[model samples]
Target: MIFLLGLALLRGRVGDREAWHCGAVLIHPRYVLTAGHCVRDPNIPNLSLLGVRLGELNLTTNPDCQLGLCSSVVDVGVEQILVHPEYNRACLACHDLALVRLSRAIENLLPQIYPICLPLDPEGELGGSTDALHNSRDWGWIAGWGSVSGDPFNAQLPTVLQKAQVPLTPTPFCDALQQRYPDPSSTLCAGGEGPFTCKGDSGGPLMIDNRMRTRWYVLGITSKGPRVCGAPNTQTLFTNVHHHLSWILSNLRP
Candidate 1:
């Protein structure tokens, strides 16, 4: 489920066509892992990315996608947008992460479209202290279309493609949420009290399921929470993708 696409120039109106403001992860076939404020928001002055929508699960009609009854969909057109060069729009989780790059190349692969495995650590260790994600299993999974009733002005978004199962908020409660949101030591705090992850589930993915569960290790990306999304102990913040995996394998281009 990928879908970034853009054209949110705002105020100066670039024709406003944002097919899915954020959420991505297709690690290659033309790369697409998102969230650097979904490719630079800086409080939104110009915005404007445009590209990414592989095997979508229904963003309200597409190739007749009655919510994952989907048969075909693959938008791809962004030819580049690599945010994290120490991204810091005043630290919502600095170095939020981004890497889109697709103008072509997604030759029909499915199981709801593929690509999502980038957490390796056989000693060439990088961030998040990987050892296949250390004491693994703090629980995961977090798909998105975002809001399901965390109403930031009536955001009832859902047409299928919204998963959740968070749990992983203990590093002294993410060090007390990095003392009120400083998060960037590679972030990584999950949520509680039933599902969480709102405002368009930022950069999507936070998977993890491999203990013979047959692979699925994405481990973080959705970055930021507590604007009342499932707010009961609140914890969201992601973006650890194994601590940038060497800045996402040196900006993946192949």
Candidate 2:
């Protein structure tokens, strides 16, 4: 997982920087995947891309950050921001994926700072023909340093990385909630009940366990949810990484 340390320049102040905003996932040694909105917006001015923080679990303090206790965290510089060509700020659900290229390739590839695998099959098959993600019983996890409360202005944001279990919403049910035509094939809906992802959780990965249950695969990217989060019967939508696999592969540096 990668935390986006967005440093937006203020309108008047030349060297002024704003706060860190969104989350992301490491998809390659130098490529990080996140929402297109996190990278650019036509309305917002003077906002510049800073970089990303890797192997980070806590944001507030490093109380027990040692060899065995915590993973070593490092902040890398951004070389480029690649938002999908079709990404539109007007449409929140369409083409929300983006990729960030680090200025330099990461040297330390530890368990905590490794890249997550993208889905190979359009149907979301994991190495085999079996569709592991088709069943609603197969649960996935979403992690981020987002605000615990629905209110964006809430000062009590979580310092430690938080995770929530979100079961895949059946396609029939998800399809019914489609607001636009041609219903985006590059999106997946989940979290009908229990804990749902909120603001600041955007661009985080929706991870599913592998067949052997040994490792997790990034199935989706956190996109949008109800205005009031965690509401019963409301499902959160994620940018389907499976559908965008080719786009991701094409953007990565060989």
Candidate 3:
């Protein structure tokens, strides 16, 4: 569990039936990144983001353990919910980014509790060629406490956190989305063939694991996906993290 894993967003309380609403990625001791929709959604007006559970591996077990190792699940109340200023619920998928400030900082990090590295970019923009993302050799993975059965409409949270490796894909949605909002940045594409993310996976990170460097970099945030998850020839779109580096840096504070 040295890599990225699922963290659950709570609506009101820890065991509340409606707490397992979305996913997030810990980026700092006191901050986590998630979708703007997760922060505030018109469809779920009654449900509010109240807290988050970090280092949670299995839903059925407390102090989740595996292979003779255990993890400490920590719940931190939400101090603030900062949705992207440009995010529009009316548009649904436009600039879907946000940062949630935890009430307190995590003092220590273990194997099950760690932060994903941000992409190594000098300009806060995608330094690698767009073609690199589409290259067949490049690989990425997504993890979450989301639907394990790949059903978008009827999302069933797995007892244990789910993870899958998905290849980067090139899709026409980027162009279509850009045509509508030319000022915004382009998107990252992946996981059309199979093992793609679903509804509850939203706000999770689309990560690139670099074993050679022993560091994990978050490439994108899990954005919108097809109505029928894992549908043949359907690619998923993610919010490119590189595009919002400045915004992320500006808001990262204790």
Candidate 4:
């Protein structure tokens, strides 16, 4: 599960105790790709970021191991932040994407905290390629630490990692929603009923396995879903990472 958590807060107010809320990961060696809203409203002075505990699926345990099995770890702080230049809070379109630059490399601490590969062709829309994705059914994985239910606006961070299944809908079905939202060119849609992303799930991964190899690949970053959480027949929108590959590489590389 190559997942990252993110949030925004008045920068200086965060204490050492609030590690989980401040965490993010490097989508590139130098750049941190997270939800655009994560770093919104930079008017506050004290901005901070923390690194997640990799390989540790459960985050509920105490860091000191006093309560339960705790993992010995050192969380790193972010040095700089860069939300997408095009981000707009009003429409919630292309600006939903963001990036952060860390002070140092976290590779040694948790190698598994590596970047998920972007698709070879981002705009190659998944709808037309039914033959390739068909055998796998409409199933896909959505991982995050969002609230279990209720409170559509507020979200609960998971003590333990959480994951759910999301089914793929036809392009025609997605097009209808896209018309209403007019999302970024890099957007993708998934979900129907039963399984969907909630409030805290934003900026997480929607993973799908290769039909032939069964290898897991991240399809997109979990974005919005029906405005309110867990609405029936509502689909989640994600920024198609593949579509922004060049932009990401250029910005994050140097």
Candidate 5:
């Protein structure tokens, strides 16, 4: 996997056993944006919350693919977790997004642990309509250290760098699916059946890794999928980063 500058990846475990599930990244030095579902736990208090680790990409060289035995974490009190105010995990559409701000600014970190550049308004619209991303058969990259497959415990944690080719689903088709499934604000869909992004990969970035100047600017965050991983009708849903650009920037500013 190719590593780039100013891309801070987030990783944490389920329970306390260290099964690294997914990642989020810094959109600004003070705020970290990830999938709302990633931080969801009905019973836990914010005080008992875990800290976020920054930096550390080892896909191509690290044999075990582990971030390291121990990682640096800040006791980020949830302060406020803006879970897409509209998000209903059951409905799974408009509210799949969320933002978390640290109680204080993080200090003394290298550029690798810096924030990612978010696209400005209309920038995300530069590509065509949602239908294009869904049906065109164009290919983009999804990054995460999640399991390559879903055999549960069969796969190890801090998974190897794996990627798959996915075709965009037509917006009309997605709209119909949304009507039936009922996520009206749905924007784009990709991946069907095997070789798609999965459980431990929520909130990860969907990017064009071919560029030389900028690392994949995030277009979407892994939002939803079928009950079973990669089912034919089951496609991965993402929050169109472009649509929420203004909301993101307003919050980022102090």
Candidate 6:
């Protein structure tokens, strides 16, 4: 597990227990992007949402440090959580994203606990267009501190953050999964054979570097996948951010 920046861990209290609920990305100083289900899923109940913890590399230690350097884990309160209106848990398809507005601004934090860049119109083509997404080479970076093993509660959670580079799988790959996987236009599939995300990795970012590798862009948000992650011929599903750019732009507020 390597140190991945711009990743935020959504923490909350569940009936006297503090838990890392889901993953999120810092897009703006005062706004974080996550999955709709993360904010409102009846299956995951009784979670008294607290805030987000940023600039973290390890979860087992306080003030995670390495090579004689340490990070000040910033915990900011959540001012509001806006789940996409079109999101429906029953369908488990499109519109499975959310936006979180922080109680205060995080402009001061940069180059450390900073925010990642959103996709922009490149080469006159719309951002997230089918052409642009495929023009780039395969694979995107996925990082998180989620469970390293089986069922979230029953599995072993990683002490250090985990990172993986998974190739952008095709629509057929997802369709063959035989699950109620959403349409490729709104969702994407990756890591079908092996090295897929496990439970507790939802709402996390699927990132890709710019042409010059100067900046990271959130390509997708971890949504759903097989219960037995890493199973043969199984893949993880992600909500394509490019497909929801309009909704995201209109909802972002400081």
Backbone atom clashes (below 3 Å) for every candidate: 3, 0, 0, 6, 5, 0
Give one digit per residue, the lDDT tens place, for model 1 in 1-254: 22222111101122474546677778777787877887677677677776666666655666534444444567767777888887775555576888877888774555446676777752332224543343545666777777789767888878667676777645454566666535445776777668888887788777765555555667778877777787666677777877678888987866
- Each candidate: RMSD: 17.5, 4.6, 3.2, 5.5, 5.2, 3.0
Which prediction has the highest lDDT against the true structure? Answer: 6
The lDDT-based order of candidates, best leading, equals 6, 3, 2, 1, 5, 4
Cα lDDT of model 5 overall?
0.56
Candidate achieving the largest TM-score: 6
The alpha-carbon root-mean-square deviation between model 2 and the true structure, to one decimal in Å, is 4.6
TM-score of each model, paired residue for residue: 0.32, 0.83, 0.86, 0.71, 0.70, 0.87
Which residue pairs does candidate 6 place in steric collision? none
Worst 10 residues of 4 by lDDT: 4-13
lDDT, model 1: 0.66
How good is model 5 by TM-score? 0.70
Candidate 2: regions farther than 4 A off: 1-17, 63-69, 89-92, 121-132, 152-155, 171-173
Q: Rate the local accuracy (lDDT) of all candidates.
A: 0.66, 0.68, 0.73, 0.55, 0.56, 0.76
Model 4 agreement with the true structure over 1-254: per-residue lDDT tens digits? 33322211112234444434322334555555666655553443353444433334556453424234334443455667667666665464554666666566645433334555455542243333433452345777777666776466566656666677877653555666567554435577887677667766666776665545323555666656676666655677776666556666767644
Off by over 4 Å in 5: 5-19, 41-48, 59-80, 89-93, 103-111, 121-137, 152-156, 159-165, 171-177, 180-183, 209-215
Give a tens-digit lDDT track for model 5, residues 1-254: 32332233444455555434556666776777777777763433332225554444553343223343322333344455666665665664555677777666755554334565565522243344434444443666666666565554465445344555565553343555566444454445666645777666777766543235344456677776655566556677776776666677777645
> What does candidate 3's lDDT look like per residue over 1-254, in tens digits?
53224354444422345567778888888888988888777566655777888878877778888887788778899889898887773366777898998899875666667777777562233435444655633567888877766665677777687877887866565455445554445457778666878877889888765546476677788888878878777767788887878899899986
| Candidate with the larger TM-score of 1 and 5 | 5
lDDT of 2 by residue, 1-254 (tens): 22221211111111375566677887777888898767775545556777687767666664316355456566788888898887874465478888988887865656446777676662444643213455634677788876788654563468777787877755454676555525466677878767778877788888776657555678778887777777666787788887777888888884
Q: Sort the predicted structures by TM-score, highest score first.
A: 6, 3, 2, 4, 5, 1
Runs off by more than 4 Å, candidate 1: 1-22, 25-33, 36-51, 58-64, 67-71, 75-78, 87-93, 99-160, 163-175, 180-191, 197-202, 205-221, 224-234, 238-254
Q: Candidate 4 regions off by >4 Å?
A: 1-26, 41-56, 62-74, 109-112, 121-137, 153-156, 170-173, 180-184, 212-215
Model 2 worst lDDT run, 10 consecutive residues: 5-14
